[model samples]
Target: MDFDLTILGSASATPMLGRHHTAQVLAVGRKQYLIDCGESTQERLIEQKIRFSRTDCIFISHLHGDHFFGLFGLLGTLHLQGRTEPLRLFGPAGLDEVLTTQLRCSGTPLSFDVQFTCVDTTQHQQVYEDAAVTVNTLPMRHRIPCCGYLFREKPGRRRLVKDLLPTGLVPEQLQALTRGEDLRDDVGHVWLRHLDVTEPPPAPRSYAYCSDTVFTESLADLVRGVDLLYHESTFLHEMLERAVQTGHSTARQAGQLARLAGAKQLLIGHFSSRYRDLEPLLEEARREFADTNLALEGLTVGL
Candidate 1:
């Protein structure tokens, strides 16, 4: 029930004072997912008191060193700690080979099952799904073959209005009534009012991640109307040209993307080292979208 997203690191490739590289921890319904682990990601987890054993899957946006350098160290630590739970990784092509070769060269052996799936961003299909949620890849404009991710929880069962029911209703009858089934009496007459006994299911929740991408308008179509959105804002509007050159988005652009996508809330991070203060970034983003917030390391967004 505690669905949230915790920011671990929010810096670009370059490391700055008080800023770590890219990493995010998405705590879904009952599982934690590591998104884009950068350098010292494991250290961040320890600092936040997050158990690495809780992470069931990892989604690497791209092969950029800043986005995935800490992966080997984390894997090594997992092996050393004797992890037995199955771990899955969703990344771009050749990620399986890259990680396998790294582990092979380092002579680190894993005690658990590790599965890797290559992401083809060109297609907008369901890449990973389960009974609880379904995740899709949202490709964006970046220097490399980077793509965003969309995490959506499936709709669950409807709520039952127990107080209105009679006290003598048995558990089996209650179960049938909750399932919208009509209960028949001895004479075969309907005894339960399905409409009056049940409430509609809540809306499905969704979170979209758009990190380390340039100001690409195409992404709006994929992330539109998302419940929450985390987009990279590496620079202020003053560095618009630099942001474009480096395949990054300015704070204003990120806000615009969020607004264009009709996101309920926007989280901006991946600050440039030159920025000693983040007021300008916040100010620019607020100009476009008033619901925008900064993605601080310890900050959490409950969805």
Candidate 2:
């Protein structure tokens, strides 16, 4: 199975000529999960050649306009395209009410169902699960109730050594071996051991998305050992005071958190429009975490 992430927008608060707002697509196999649909996200998705109908879920970190304002337009476009599949949405408590009111005011009846799940921003808990992946909420320190999302791939079945298997083994016995179970005879005598016939599966991969949040050491514990960590870096260290005052993080802080969490790779974005050149921010983060990368529009990273 292939796991990848595509950056749609990276600007924070305001949209610029070259940069848009915050939005990303995490693709696990054929299923696509949209995170933070900021303004013009649908346009970005189209630019990336990702189908709107392929989105399996949408996750909004908070009610901030720069994070969720694009959702309304995306929903309306889906309806116009005559989509009938239900879309699962996870976000803060007031999201459902806001969405409902918007549709009502616009007099636009959706062609598909929107299944909303309110996320508790204060608790770290499992919010979604399927055969391929599991999603958990990571509490964040923001001006409003906000949370990050952690996505982890499920471990696959052990690989079978076909040449080592016995000739008379039944289908059920082979299945048991793939599941790392010992095969036994009707009399309960062990005939084959899983360890002898199978190799361990590939280790699961994990990605954590930390939206607008203040510098907090405690966040490292929640995303410890993550394969990829995408943290919002709204300003450089020179504007650290402004970052703290607005409950936003600096690029240096994002790097520090990634280093403390032992993350394999760090993606820093959600940049403030004040800086025209982003190389300085990248340099600031790389001082703490060498594997840091900038989240640019239409850039896709594989995990």
Candidate 3:
């Protein structure tokens, strides 16, 4: 199974000279999930060569323009492309109402159904689950109703040691071994034990996306030991007061949160436009968390 993340946009509040807004695409196996559709997100998707039809779900962290303004355009483009599959949309309350208003005003009947799920930003709960992955909401402290998302890959079956298999074993016996079940003969005699023939499954991988959130220590508990963490670093530590006032986190704080959560890798993005040079922000975060990296547009990370 392949787990990858592609950053589409990383600017905070507004688009900059070289950066767009906040948006990303997370690929879990064959399923693709869109997180935050900021302005020009469709263009970014096109640039990345990710087909729109492949994206079955879209998650909006909050109602801020920088986070979800591109959703209307993306939905409209999907209709134009003749997409008929139902698209599942998860977001905070009032999102459905706003989307409905946009559709009504434009008089564009979509070809596909938009199944909306309103997430409670104040609660930590499992919001979506499939055979390959599970998505949970991480309550965040922001100016408005907002929440981050935690994506976890499901555990796979045990692997069998081909050399240890008995001669003339049927397909059913192999399947049973993968399920951790002992194989017994038709005469009720134990042929081979599962533990001797199979190895433990690979450990599950997890990724956390925290966007436009203020410094919250409680978040560390929710995403402890995540393989990858993408936290918003909208300002440098010198501007900590402004970051707190705007419900955003500084680069150093983002690094500290990553360290506290025991994340394996940290990707810091959602940068404020005031800083033309981003090396300073990256350096600041790296000082706190040595494995921290800047989340740039068109960058893909594999887990």
TM-score ranking from best to worst?
3, 2, 1
Stretches of candidate 1 off by over 4 Å are: 176-190
Backbone clash tally for model 3?
Answer: 0
Q: Write the per-residue lDDT of candidate 2 for residues 52-84, one digit (tens) a residue.
A: 798869999999999999999999999999999
**How many clashing residue pairs appear in each of the predictions shown?**
0, 0, 0
Pairs with steric clashes in candidate 1 = none
Candidate number that wins on TM-score, 1 or 3 = 3
Say what the RMSD of model 2 is. Answer: 1.2
In model 3, how large is the Cα lDDT of residue 119? 98
Candidate with top TM-score is 3
Reference-based TM-score of each model: 0.94, 0.97, 0.98
Q: Which stretches of candidate 2 lie over 4 Å from their true place?
A: 168-171
Error of 3 at 39 (Å): 0.9
Angstrom error of the Cα, residue 295, model 2: value is: 0.6
CA lDDT of 71 in candidate 1?
89
